[model samples]
Target: MAPVSLKKLVKRYGALEVVHGIDLEVKDREFVALVGPSGCGKSTTLRMIAGLEDVSGGTIEIGDNVVNDLPPRARNISMVFQSYALYPHMTVGENMGFSLKIAGRPPEEIKEKVADAAAILDLTHLLERRPSQLSGGQRQRVAMGRAIVRRPDVFLFDEPLSNLDAKLRTQVRTEIKKLHARMQATMIYVTHDQVEAMTLSDRIVIMRDGHIEQVGTPEEVFNRPLTKFVAGFIGSPPMNMDDVTVADGKLVFASGATLPIPPKFRQSLTSGQKLTFGLRPDDFFPTGHGLNSGDAEAVAELELPVSITEPLGNETLVFVGFNGRDWVSRMLNPRPLPSGQSIKMSFDLSQAHLFDLTTGKSLVA
Candidate 1:
């Protein structure tokens, strides 16, 4: 396995720069995921590493050697794409061993490698079946098996499970994780799905506008987002960001409501500070320890009208309007609640996040 590094990498088309001076390091045997919305240059970065795209600047290093001038065949990297790209007419075993055969390896060597990959991917029994005879998940495994047979220094996965159904995608995710564990190979994966990134990555690179927003573990990104975009984007149901201002050394939202700020945040506040207050839905509870007690710092309470309720089997998702903005909160064992009715909601003050209204930087120290 090899450690991959990109130094000040830049990609451009004519005069328009898409990827602007991005640097990344994937340690040997590390599973790193590049996650973001479309057009964030993640796919471009992966393609550049695969030698499929021309890099406008910087160098790509596999181990200690610079591979900027290398071709796809010389890069010693294997890529499993969103589409499995399996040959439809070929049997699973044939498809898996095709690369080896084309390279004129001995028949015995090809058979041994193919058998090993099939066992690793649990496709031993399905080796003789054609692509049309296999399920989506099976085809994905075959694509991965093809990559594994080559034993490339680095494995690049580009949303390999996106084509599968929801249940199949979940199943395949576990399988892929197990494969990585057993192989302990260097991997760099790209996806727009946050759930995939959260579950699969040891470290996730969050990108926006061709720039890295944050790079951290799933828990760090979820529990302690550094930017307003990250705070709102990485979570399910998204974080509620209320436009607030510093009033009398306290954070006040719309409807003349006040929530106390930790002293650590006060140092970064503007004179007539306009900020965005962030609260994750998971942090709010139907019942909390403390309610609003003006001068003393405590959990802030706000009354909001229930706008909609979505029952999600295990839990109910309740949507409400507060401070002229909509917020979604997850509730356990939630019975159906009528819309247009008012209910009191309390937020955990200790779990709150604050961001600069203009700069979008976090106010938390």
Candidate 2:
């Protein structure tokens, strides 16, 4: 029952407060990711949880006890940093067993623990190799092996895969996921990559300006973002957004382009209200290439000119001219379209999002 609970957590230096009073709960053996752009205080928050940074306000509980006053070692947590932080001179086995050695554990116990972790991480064959002898991915496995030997209640990972190349990152990401399944430890990962957060975490905590924007499962956050920022930030290629004014039950773009207000938002909207219209590339597609198969009544069709096309293997990204700007649409089973050619484009209004322009909040419900 090693659940982690943060109650009104805060971090400050002098008069400058960085992490605001944020509350979060990570269930036992649950993987949670803290993700946001740089300077969002995600790493700071993780450090505070690991006791590497002093808490300025409120309590942090690991399991059933408050750990604010505990030191990093006493808190019984293992952290794997972005920089492998391995001993250059020590062999893989030595590096993994160093913590236990320093703690005055029996030599045989240390050896057994290191061997078990090495086997789990597929490092048994490389136990004799030093950090310099290992590849980037192998070195990362050693880092994870070191953390695994500790057998802590919680595992803290601070952008551990950022240093690796894309291919290596993917490999290590899968390894980390498998490690979590085998260990069932309460792991808290901090990364700026939303893809990593989406693929690795059971739930995601999206942060902005030192504050938590939203916390939800990947599917929840993707299909139903609570705020405009969440909708725009969580998706790759991002959601297309444009400012509009409500007029005669229509959303009128600044360039005089008008679209019928999404049916679901009709009751919540008022004429003359300003809004930010959002539609993902998947929802706005070249007709016959979209993913949606239901509710044609809310779909809007237009003969829009194609501005550009990016062919990506199984699908293509088509940028169409709309509302004085280029709106991207995803095309499946793609066909080559010459630039500037007029094509029938579909906007699945059933999946469109409307946000308050001033507040940047979702208008549905």
The models' CA-based lDDT, in order, is 0.85, 0.94
Error of 2 at 296 (Å): 0.5
Residues 1-365 of candidate 1 have per-residue lDDT tens digits of 99999999999999999999898988999999999999999999999999999989999999898998899888778899999989999999999998889879999999999999999889999999999999889999999999889888999999888899999999989988887898889999999999998999899999889888888889999988989988987989888888888878888777786777754475666556899888888766444323232323445567778898888987777888877667888776676779998887777666788888898988763
Model 1 global lDDT (CA atoms, 0 to 1): 0.85
Residue runs of model 1 more than 4 Å from their true location after superposition? 262-271, 288-297
**Regions of candidate 2 where Cα sits further than 4 Å from its true position:** none
> Considering every candidate listed, which one attains the maximal lDDT?
2
Model 1 is weakest, by summed lDDT over 10 consecutive residues, at 287-296
> Candidate 2's C-alpha lDDT?
0.94
- Model 1 pairs whose backbones collide: none
Task: State the displacement of the C-alpha of residue 118, model 2, in Å, after optimal TM-score superposition.
Answer: 1.3
Report the error of model 1 at residue 112, Å. 1.8
